[model samples]
Target: MNAINSQKKHVFFRRVSTAGQDIITQEAADLPFREKLSDDEILIINEIATSANKKAIKERPEMQRLISLVKDKKVHSIYAFDRSRLFRDFYEGMEFNDLRAKYDVQVIYTSVGNGNMPASDDVFVEGLLSMFSDIEGKNIARRSREARLRYPAKKFGYQKQKETKRFLHDSSKSKGVQQYFAALKEISSLDDLYKVTKEYRKKLKKTDEQLVSMATDPFYAGYDLEKGTNKLQHVTPYISIEEFLQLQRVNGEFFKAFLERKKSLMCQNIYTPCCGYCRKPLFYKIEEESNSSYYSCSSKLHPKVTVSFSDLSKIIGGILSEIIQNFNAEKLINQSINCYRTIKKHLEAEMDSIDQNLNGIIEELVLGSDDYSADWKQDPMYKRKQLLKQEYHNCLEQIKENQNALQKNKSVIKVIEEALINQSNMNPSMLCDMLINGIWIYGDNLQVDVFYFDYLQEMEKEMIFEGEDIA
Candidate 1:
């Protein structure tokens, strides 16, 4: 075959379970497949250390490279001593079929290998092997889970293995053992000693959290295998048995609280709803009159009822965002002052006009002219006089209100100034809270309204212009 064509080389594939299983020996054993293929063909060997589970293949670098080679059409076919050597699981077997159909890579099994089952029985044999592999994997997981049941009862300690003939600890160096015992004497109880040890850990920048973690871990206990009873040759203990048990109790309570918090955070009800103005999670409320349950945001139920979920309220919210973008604090204050002066001038002019009209009405009344009482009921002059007086007073009130709002808004500028000068080391979750009020699910489409759109837009613009590497 080598003499026939250099490009058409047969590839020999082999695998081993562990480093102890030599690849060369396995290749020599599968010589029949080599003989069947051309002598000119290249050989590719891949060793998988772990059980050839789906996760293993997906993560294995060699298997990934093999797939890449097949995709590139570099290999005409794949040869293995047995299908299990390729993959013990059926999913992987089907993946092999997909490679063959898609890339024209034929699979060859040596007749001498256990993987050399007849071609007719390949389907059934592979399926059975996969089922057995899955069952084995599941059993291993179950056993590992069960072994952890002893964790609460067991304490951390070192035991010399008979085969290795080594003691786990020695207080010989720097009289370290004597020093630890001396320090332990100062503590009134084990708990006090534990606290003192924790303080020492902090000087080393360690935490009680790390200590608690070691208590639950089974690795330091000397077993070579977690799921199986493969005890290693030797082990050493680091902490006292009493301390380890105490650590476990504290850790168990901490973990239980941590899990409960995780569950509640995952639940959707604690989150804000789109129709509320509070931007905070709604609290349940009862309507005493109707005995009906209702949920309302904190802002709506509180003083002044500043926000609502009504259409007009939503429109006002949108307008406020736009106004915040367009009107900076200093500029708004100047504009408001100018507007107030103009309004005051207009009101003064109207007052002047109303005074002239009142003089005319007084003169008519003094003359006792033309049935004045009847004229009051039917005359446009009387109505105009009353309307002008009300308008003047309303204008003055509006100008005063605008001036006050302007002053308050000016005060708000100090907060903005402080924030703008400060560094933004914001947490991601906190940033999310500041932006998203709540999303409204309308049929298939979602309506997302941001409470801080103006600020977000300003930040985004700054980020884009900063020319930082996005990656």
Candidate 2:
């Protein structure tokens, strides 16, 4: 159907696939919706992974915009190629349906019929269709899993059968792996192995998985054996299969445990893309008493620019206080006033009637005898108790919301102030996420580039334009 007022109504489309499939490709495979809307009308297409549950929807930045438009009823209709494109899981599908039905939103399947489609399909039918679709999707997934299990064992660590052996054993590609193992064999202690490997990994920028995989894979020993596939190659082995398996058994266990630990630390710490020193994208660490964790230099672990965890935490706390102090109290108060005005506008008509009746009752009481309890007790003004209670509740809610907003603004102010203070003690971990854009640490010095602090500093120039006096 032709979309009237298309320029004003927003439209959204999404494709969910883990294989990095773009809308262009997906559209080629399956037809997209036909829209007679203007080219200027806003259309958003998000690429998401279907394997990841609906919770993963938050990762797509466009999802938030879609949710806002739905919530505000700014978008009159949402169109997808099919129901699966909208949602695959039953619960997530129900959520999408609820949004459409509750908001009077139209969900149109682009590949299906246009406005001619039945309006009487009903929610229950939609729900049943979605459930069947989910079951079908799960069946397809099971078939794919079975197909993957049928791949040759020789291709396990070597390469996919679809991919060539030349790609796997390419001399240049295997050089780093070969060198790492050669070095590993030369090492006598775990410390030396760690140090050497750490330096090598830094130079290679290899992920933990790649590094661990290279260390454990027996495919390099003329036998390709991994979780799903195993095979034997006619080529000469780099190491015996027995030896390779033994080393993998021992080292694989260690590496797996190490990865778990690394993941845990990452979750606990605030690792920023910005360097603390030099405002570059690097982080350092200072591992003092074995158990204590702190950020140090990116240049080297033993760089003199290192700051202890205690010192970093203290500096951050002090900066936080300073930031809080600099908050624009006048601005916050004005925001509260605006909130109060909005609420007052909503209640003004009711309040006016209440005031008129109240005044009339007061005048009547004055004119009547002091013992005129019967008239006062049966008054129409007394019946306004429920309306007054509603008004009181609305006022209270607005006030609470305004206070919460003010509190949030104050917190941001605090973070800004703490960032500016040149404190000796700062917990690089705690303040790093809040204040730091990047930290660059070199041999003997460190530089911290704080985006929030820098932005506030820039705003200081605006005061002059506004004819505001500086303190």
Candidate 3:
């Protein structure tokens, strides 16, 4: 389409499902409409070999171009052979109509395709036919998809026979795939599985999650879960159903081991996120020779900044013990109580704003409503009213939740205060994250930064809620 923004354009758009078909006859019938239009004002949109049932309007190349013209307000009118040439579904018709409405464009259908079904003049009749066409097109698409259920495309580690169309194992990848499955027995953690993944999955590049999903997929076991015993999918099992079950057991064991090894380290992940010197994330690793856990930076640095887990535990324990001995628990409890009370006040003010806004929209909807119309439910105002009611209910739910939190906060504060008094009860694992900001080990000096505080305003968010109860 030639988009001369200053000038109006009349578009003649045509589509055919296959390369064997053409819009010559339709073009001849539409030629009369073009005679009245100037050369600059005419835009011919021809979509060849494009299936409306297979592809949507946006997916079709020529149709997308025509839509762009309409959206830009460069189109004055659209001419087609028939409605089916433009729309095979009701949604397509509705969308095309909406675009025309927005850009002040007109539409004209010359005639029906082959006249098996005639084009109607009445708006009501056209609407009924459009709905039927939409359902029929969807039914045809479903049938087409079902007809090609046994497409020759084969999965990984297999190939489809060209002559017989039967799936057979490719000797090359099948051996590697089988090896990967066998290696599952040795996998104790995600690390072991990932190393094996790097070795075997040279050709198959996939994310960690995708590899896990593919490992569990039943298709590799030579059967579909939906297909009963009478029918297995046309694929040879490189890994037998029995072997697949064994591998799943191994995978489950690996998951358990991974979770078991993960421990709560006070300054590992959050507070001491990275090595202060190297600026690399720190992770926990066991020294194989000594079998001692150490928090070390991932990056290898000169004069490595690392700390032993046992040393870390003692350092954090000492800090918390000293804080507990000197800390004023009564002042903290009083401040926390006042904070919750202030939060409740803000929540109440927010609820009031939501109510006032909802009420104004409800009044406007009631005033502008067409009482006699049967399609009042379909109105934009009616939809907005429903949305406002939902928003109001959500705010009310939040306010009620805050009320419950206010009561729970008191008991939680009391329990936390009691835990601090008895230093033995205060687990450094729970309190250290809130108390310390960062820790850096350099040469012989171990440095710790205490978390800064806004004494008047801030509170550590639900440390009691997250950690185990000490009450």
Candidate 4:
């Protein structure tokens, strides 16, 4: 026994999913006879690494440490209960083979092929076994995903029955669920619903997303995945499927209108301008009853100031009127030409730089090491190539936007001149949209920024240049 133990050295690597402590212990105890080795051949019982609930070999820290031992020539052989217990992917099998060849180490399985060494036939069999394991793992994942989409038995208001695997509503939880649906039906507006939710939130401790899911998920109305429809009569439902659908339709319309109004009121080209004092964009507010909107300073640290839509429109109109009345066609034309030239130069330089970076990445990808094919999916060079491609597309989009803006700027004077010809036809909203870019309000004072095409182009170029420098 002493001679055999001294001549043969081995390390036991055990891994299992949950509730595997007993299985691992039993395997370790039976290792000597199972692998035909003496009991003294066990290198270190205390040092045996066990990873629980880690299905992937690469994701397991303990397994990585064990692999490091093999790399450092600290272990002669690795013993596991079976090959499936060691790896669930073919790539992992290839990696293990590479490690074995590189470090002159061996892996022996107690149950698989009754412990075989690395040879042509053994390698082929191992590859086949790994493929089977990978397929089995994928099948299990697909089954789990399908089960979720089909059953989705576990829910907030219901408990799953152990014996039957059926869902039944808990009386205590069902009451809250019923009350929540009742409130949804009773509320006339989103504001009222929010207020009711706040009261319920004290006890429910549900997040906004969970509350939304509760309101929208068809399960509450007794959804059957097999039929892909709500079977309200099939199971005892808290709310009728018809009522649930009606609520969704109504709320969905309300949400859509709310978003549209928000977009219009907070339009970046017209609304987003810094406060004169605080240099921060004003926060928007709407009075539901009056339908009057106002933009006010948001900072609590700064003195409060509010400006109505009417006042802002008047201020911006006066500024546009002045610019139109004091029109300078030749000066504006020269300015536009100069700005276009500068922008063209900067854009061409940026495009050239992006092209160089992209070519470098492509060159590295083509001339990468022999193992690049195996590792390229996770390689840094591949990630850089994807990022550079995205950046190149973004630059192209910016160039397009800048050219369109230049054309719009050249036509601004014509638009304003025509509006001034018929002074009565000049609408505040129309004028604001046509000429004004943004308006800033400070106490009683207002700052109106009229969009001169040349100035806008130069600002955009500077912004893009600064962003590129930062990147």
Native-to-model Cα distance after best TM-score fit, residue 421 in candidate 4, in Å = 40
CA lDDT, every model vs. true structure: 0.50, 0.55, 0.67, 0.64
Q: List ranges where model 1 is wrong by over 4 Å.
A: 1-9, 17-21, 36-39, 48-51, 54-58, 88-90, 101-104, 111-125, 137-167, 170-210, 218-247, 255-471
Residue 50 lDDT (model 4): 35
Q: How close is candidate 4 to the true structure, as a TM-score?
A: 0.44
Better of 2 and 4 by TM-score: 2
Could you list the CA RMSD of all candidates, in the order they appear? 25.0, 12.5, 15.8, 18.4
> Candidate 3: misplaced stretches above 4 Å?
12-39, 44-68, 79-92, 101-104, 108-111, 115-149, 152-154, 181-207, 216-218, 224-234, 239-471
- The clash count for each model shown is 4, 34, 0, 0
Whose lDDT is greatest here? 3
Local accuracy of candidate 3 as per-residue lDDT tens digits, 376-410 = 77878678778867876786787678778766776
Tens-digit lDDT track of model 2 for 1-471: 223342445465667666566676445423333345554554555656645233445665566666667777777667666776766678777777787678787776655553223322477877788787789778877666554434334432234334443324445445655666666565454455456557677755776556666666555665655344454544445566776766766556566655565565555445543344354444545331142456644554344455544444444444444444454545655665677667656666656666666666566656754666476656564555546556656766765776677667667655645553533234445545565555454454344455553223222311111113111
Q: Could you tell me which 10 consecutive residues in candidate 1 have the lowest summed lDDT? A: 461-470
Expressed as tens digits, the lDDT of each residue in 254-305 for candidate 1 is 4344334434433422224433333444454432222223344445353322
Per-residue lDDT of model 4, residues 344-446, tens digit only: 7787788889899989888877886677448676888889888878877887887788788878877885674576545524455566666667666777666
TM-score comparison, 2 vs 3, better candidate:
2
Could you tell me the TM-score of candidate 3? 0.43
- Supply candidate 1's per-residue lDDT for 102: 78
